[model samples]
Target chain A: MSVLIFAELDEGALKKSSLEAIYYGSKVAALTGTSTTAIVLGEGNADELAKAGRFGATKVLHASDAQLNEGNAMAYASVVAEAANQEGADVIVLAKSSLADSMAARLAGKLKAGLAANVIELPDVSSGFRVKRSIFTGKAFAFTELTAEKKILAIKKNTITPEETEATATVEAFKPALNDTDFAVKVTNVEKATGDILLPEADLVVSAGRGLKGPENWGIVEDLAKALHAATACSKPVSDLDWRPHHEHVGQTGIKISPNLYIACGISGAIQHLAGVNSSKVIVVINKDPEAPFFKSADYGIVGDVFEVLPRLTKAVQEL
Target chain B: MKILVCVTSVPDTITKITLTDNNTKLNKAGVQFITGPYDDYALSRAVELKEQLGGTVTVLNVGESDADPVIRKCLAIGADDAIRVNAEPTDAYFVAEQIAAIAKENSYDLILMGRESIDYNGGQVHGIVGEMLGLPSISPVMKLAVEGTTAKITREIEGGHEELEAGLPLVLGCQEPIAEWKIPNMRGIMSARTKPLKVVEATGKDTLTHITNYELPPARGACKMIPASEAETLIKLLRTEAKVI
Candidate 1:
């Protein structure tokens, strides 16, 4: 028995979420009495690929085809399925992301594997292989059992804590059979967000709603985000009004995030908004309304006006 | 272009999540259902494309009769027709198999769906269907435009976006900014009453997974109130007590 983990790369560097997956996979391998092997596709530095060992993989398989870097779901799934077969893996683990989820769907179909998406906890091997996952957009949880011979898990980001080791993985060159059909989706251009943290991957997030009034008042939110090196997000109304980009909206109808710290300013906690961020580890709500529904779900609360509270909070963060 | 857009009927986002039947099923007593928010984007884009490209848009749902009204809403929003696979949509693989079987029979020129259903949030059907049909799939597509037989797509990625091109007969999982959600006009709603709604039996029976139990997340303790005048202390608490920074 073996575990195969897909360590996806972003612009030639291993992603933090991928490292977390390797660590999570190693724990599963220990429970199953198997070894963990990490398969890395696309173009990446050899040294960076070897960091898989630092997170817990015993071996690293590097598939260096340039076409693998295109983010084609079908092609990536084919390569991952091939790696799983070659490694004789019974379980495949991956970090949850748009790219990973897309590939996992095809991987499940190709391998006939039982896939559990958005898995939040390690499987309970004490009984059957059961996994707990978030459902209803993180409003509830479901314990699901995989009934297939092969299994795939797409674990939610930031759910597991990773540990580093001094160990080194034995890197091996792996070349999966490829053809022109594998590159069916042709990538024309790539535009990467420069300098700003992406909300989905952020650890700390500063968010607001209509309470900030207009788009011009966003400087306060941005100031706090810059001080803490966090990402900026808004409630649905802010995005709907075009005060912020739709991508920056975090709510039931927008991007769902589980950042370690989520600071909401001037936003009333509508049930829809809470569904998107209720899973956040620590929530701080700053609202003038004392009866705001968001305060009930918050770890901390400040009853005050946004105009007065935000600048003070930004200064406090800067002082720190 | 013949477009197939798959949608899911989910409890409104404002509804509190509650499970029944010994915690194995969602309680539907008073819950109102709507098209999955992400799927609404896909349906809107499909309608827009059909208008610009001059084609028919058919919406499909893998659910029981409870989803018929939701599927009709799709038609009211300008879908040419509708299909509902008669099943409970228990597993992601099972749903994908049904969709793939239907797609094989129809041979749609383009397939679209939301990134994932809001209830299950699997986000897996599109690629699984594409794989089963031997077609390429792009997911969480934010922007899509078709010229001739080629589609220029911009998909969301971690930290940024990527622009790609692919031919027709492809599957795409769409999200926001692809198109605005379309509300049904009076004429559209009236015409939907007569639109063909096909009901089909599911061909797939093998479910790879099952929910063993359900759980609600633990309720948080009372919020520790911090005075606005002493906002700096909150940061200190975050640093020293929470240790997040």
Candidate 2:
């Protein structure tokens, strides 16, 4: 039996989440006493996929197709399902990011396999493949077992730390049958933000709310984030008021993040907003109002005007 | 064009999560259930689209009898009819199987659902159903428009966004940028009582994933406060004590 992992790539480079998946897939392969192979869609450097061997992959299947450059959920799912069938893979793994979840679910249905999504821990293969996942907005955990012959799993991002080992894996080119309908959804244009850290992938996050007063005072938050090498985020109200872009908004109505550390400045945490960041390992809240709801959930709290507190914090971080 | 929008009942966002003594089941004493927020967006968007395109809109909920109130609420909001799968939602896989069965028997032109249910947040149903029925699935969609048999959608990417075009027989996982939610009017609420709500037993595969138990996260530490005047000191503290900076 072989384990097949879907390696995600953007503009021909592997994403960090894909690396994490490779690590988890490698472990599963080791536990099952099976070989691990990686399948990449579109044009990716074979050398990069082969490097996944450090994480347990014995081979990399690079499916290079010009039409597959842009992500089409149906097409991607078809390709992965076909690759698994061709390789006789018993298990298929992917990162639980937007693209992977979308494709994994569909692939499971196509293969008539069992699916485990948002998995946070490695599987226990001694019995059946039992995986652990978060439920109810990180309020609870669920341990599940795959009962079907084929299994598909979407591993959560940043859940598993990547460990390295030395090995050289072979790279092979595979082609899947495609048609016009497979590319029905044509990506007309692509837009990317100009920043070093993407909020979803950032380990440390520095966020602000309406408490910052206005856009003019944002420099302090930005400075602190830069010094800490953290991505900047905003509450819904700030994004609604146009102080920050909607993409930077993190709340129940926005993106849900579980960074290692989340620093909130001038933000009064509402339950809706808390539902998003409650998964952070550590939370620090800075608000002038001592009774702000955010403080209740914070591991550390600072009761002060963010405008004054942020600059000082920025300077201290600069010194460090 | 007939649009079928699926909704799921989920725990309220602010509900305090607690586990049963065994750790395998959720403690439901203080938990209040509500319609999944993402489904609300899908319902509202479908209603608006039907209004503009002159079509019928139906809301489907795959859950036990307790979901009737929310299913009625969907009808009040503008859905022409409602369908409640008479079964406890075992898992995403089981739920998708039920929805796919309904879609196939009904022949819906378009299927819409929230990106994921808040309770489980698996984000799997739309894609699974699409695959089951051989349809295109677009997720985390910010913009959508229907013209004849084609749909134009804008999907959210990591840094920015990407626009795509797909034909009919498609599935869309609606998110925030779809449209503003509309509250039900008194007239609609009154008329919802008379709308037909069909409840059917679930049919298809068994759940592959089962919950072992629920666990509440550890409580947060006490808040720390620094005077507004000592902002710089707080920053220094973060650099040294907190180490975040």
Candidate 3:
């Protein structure tokens, strides 16, 4: 009866969400009177893997398989299940990353574990294991009880805070038996969007909507985001119009974000849009229409033309 | 090519989510149900592939009679036929099991669905079904083109996207940019009335997890409105008062 955390990496470093999952697993281990083990299924720095203990894991296992580095869900699931079995783990914890989304279900199916995904809080294990999670794309929440003997939790990002300690984990090499069929899906090419803060992990995000008018008017939004060192996002209509890439669209059907601060320019708050961003710590709406639905949900608001207000806000952040 | 596309009915995106039945169920009164927005992308792409590759496109749903209209909508949009597993899709695994059972009975070359259903937002069905059938499951697919038995796919990751190649008997969870949403034409709508709609009993009944309760997020406080000319002051407020930036 132990907790196993899958420590995912970004550029050979542990992702912030994965660190939080380590902490989350440790907390669950403490509650259940068990130890926590962190496993890196792919290539990762040995020194960085050892730091999993700082986030509360008791030990770290490095698979160090180059084939596992690419986002291959089937192969990843096989390795994770093997690691869990070897560690005698009944609880598997993972960050709700795209990688996790792709593999967690496969892992659950392989291990016959009950999975609670998009979990936002630690489980209440007083009786049956119940976990709170965001549902309906952040419009509502649900408390679900896992009834299976083994449990899998894919926790949402920016929800759990990671605490560090002075301890370093003992790192050991681990090899999991693999099946050839697991590598059927071949990753032919990898293209990473460069030079901008990744929206999912960005602390602050600056977004605009249709009111920006055209693609050329996006300079002001970019300027504001650059000044604040924030990621840029746009509404669904903007993406639908080809004014921005679909990846930059933030809405119920698009990328949902819960940053520390979210600034919206010239965007009326539709429920679809609000569903994605209502979880932000602070929301600022800048729209010409005072009656724009966004103001009702904003922490701070300004009724003004985006063309005028965005530059002023950019200058202010740059000055700060 | 025989493509099986799974879809579900969700509360309209604009519907204000409300709880009823002692907070254990969603309030359906006055709520309009529509095809899951993300699933539309999957259906459209599947239809496009069938047009290009000379194959049959079938729509599948794990739901009760309430989902018939939504499944019919898919047929109207160019799905040759439809199947509804007569059961409530109460859990992700349960739904996946039903899908896997159907896929086994009929060897679908490719299976597609939304990245996740809007209602549960589990995003787990494709992987689970893929594992159950020993097929490759790639999700949030933004671009997919098929040639012979191979599929050229691009999927969204955290920061960017990845291009991949997979043989048939693949499961993909699709999203936008795969293809534009196809609205039902008048001719298609007329023919949809005569399309084959098969209703099958659900094979999987056990749900590993159950929701104990539903909750609405806390309400927002009053907005602190700043004058248009004093937009910079809002930044100071964000720094000192909100302290987020």
lDDT of 2 by residue, A1-320 (tens): 79999988866777778888888888888888888898888987766776777676788888898878777777888899889999999899898666777788678778878887778888878777788877766666778778888988887766788987888678888899875666667787777786568787788999999988898888889898998899999998998888887778888868878887899998899988987888887788888888798888887777877877777777776876
Better of 2 and 3 by TM-score: 3
Name the candidate that leads on DockQ. Answer: 3
Candidate 2 collision pairs:
A301-B224, A303-B225, A312-B232, A313-B235, B23-B213, B24-B212, B24-B213
Taking the tens digit of each residue's C-alpha lDDT, what string does model 1 give over B1-245?
99999999999888888889998877889999999999999999999999998989999999999999999899999999999999999898898999899999998988999988899889888888888898888888999999998999998876668899999889999998899999999999999999999999999698999898999899998899999888888999999998998
lDDT of 3 by residue, A1-320 (tens): 78999888887888877898999999999999999999887888767886798999998988888888776788888998998999899999998877888889789888878888878889999999999999998889999999988899988777777889898888989998879999888888888888778888788999999999999999999999998899999999999999988788898989888889999998999999998898888999999999999999998999999999999988998889
- State the TM-score, rounded to 2 decimals, of chain A in model 2: 0.93
lDDT tens digits, residue span B1-245, model 2: 89999999888888877777788777778678888898898889899999999889988998888889888889999999999989889887799989998998898888999998988878888988887787888898878899888888888877677888888989999887687887899999999999999988889757876665555666766666666676566656655776654
Ranking by TM-score: 3, 1, 2
lDDT of 3 by residue, B99-191 (tens): 999999999999999999999888989988988998889998999999888999998887778899989989999999899999999998899
lDDT of every model, 2 decimals: 0.90, 0.83, 0.90
* Tens-digit lDDT string for candidate 1 (A44-90): 89788878999999999999988787666777888999999999999
Name the candidate that leads on TM-score: 3
Per-model TM against the reference = 0.96, 0.94, 0.97
Each model's interface RMSD (Å)? 1.3, 2.0, 1.1
Candidate 1's TM-score reads 0.96
Docking class for candidate 1: medium
Error of 3 at B58 (Å): 1.4
